[model samples]
Target: MRKNSIKNTRVNVEVQHELANLIREGIKDPRIHPMTSVTAVEVAPDLKTCRAYISVMGNEEAKNNTIVGLKSAEGYIRRQLAKNINLRNTPEIRFILDESIEYGVAMSKLIDEVTGKEEVQEDGENNQ
Candidate 1:
């Protein structure tokens, strides 16, 4: 079996990083919550549209508010992105809540709890 390289994935990652930084330092939307971070960017093969995944580290209200804020400023963001990225056509912006990072943290906690169980004395030899 051959190990495949994730060239496209790497490209997407780079784009995500740049986009995240751009959003953090460039746009200052009043609706945007203070704790928002761009988590991922999914660009289509044609690169016509890019889904920007955002993560907000706050309560449900804060999360919803941040997304609403971003949605309202889509046009401004698209323009800013166009100024930054050189492309034939600027990709349409779509803001999506990325819960994967939050989910991963939760999963890690659960896994730790489960693995800690293994340290307990089940029988005696099994504990070792």
Candidate 2:
């Protein structure tokens, strides 16, 4: 088992993919929003702990609600995965709010603002 990169780690990748699919298709929790996505799942090589980073496409309150929903269903999720996946022990599941989406959205907005300002200035100079 080479702990090189995410691609090489089959256990981690497979488990994450299976779990994400399970949550997306199987679980029916009302608190979970429709646009929730599993951004990434990181599991220890020993299959001890699994951290699932999720992103909700909405405001802060919506994100918080989604996290709460996931936390409530964590046990059920783990149990289901254990029954489904062939493993000696199912890794513990921890749901975490992924901030990369938020960061990227903010960065893009900043870039757009700067570019818009530049365009306006260029047009003004041309007209003068």
Candidate 3:
């Protein structure tokens, strides 16, 4: 299949959704935080490997632990996924920590602070 074919896109989306559900309800590992979520999924064209992007809402330690826990449970998760979805081959799943959300939030806060300062300066000038 072509790398960017419609079939590949559909498979990627399906895998992402199923993986998120499995992590959310199937896995009971304590290391995986409740705030964990599947942010994205990239599957190889041959369906041999998949990179699952996960986001955790907590400190660095929690995020590391969540990735570790997911790595340990990769096999089981793949098996469950295969059973749920009729895929010819179950891809080797790799969990990755995604910090885009955190980065976006930080950027937004910085913008707000800058805009707030500009507003304050304008108010002062108006009052002067």
On TM-score, the leading prediction is 3
Better of 1 and 2 by lDDT: 2
The deviation in Å at residue 109 for candidate 1 is 0.8
TM-score for each predicted model, relative to the true structure: 0.77, 0.86, 0.96
* Per-residue lDDT of candidate 3, residues 7-65 (tens digit): 88899999999999999999999999999999999999889999999999999999999
- A best-first ranking of the candidates according to their TM-score comes to 3, 2, 1
lDDT of 3: 0.94
On lDDT, the stronger of 1 and 3 is 3
Report clash pairs, candidate 3. none
Instruction: Using lDDT, give the best candidate's number.
Output: 3
Q: Runs in model 2 with CA error above 4 Å?
A: 1-8
User: TM-score of the candidate numbered 3?
Assistant: 0.96
Pull out the clashing pairs in model 2.
Answer: none
Off by over 4 Å in 3: 1-3
Model 1, span 41-80: residue lDDT tens: 8776566888888999888988898889888878877787
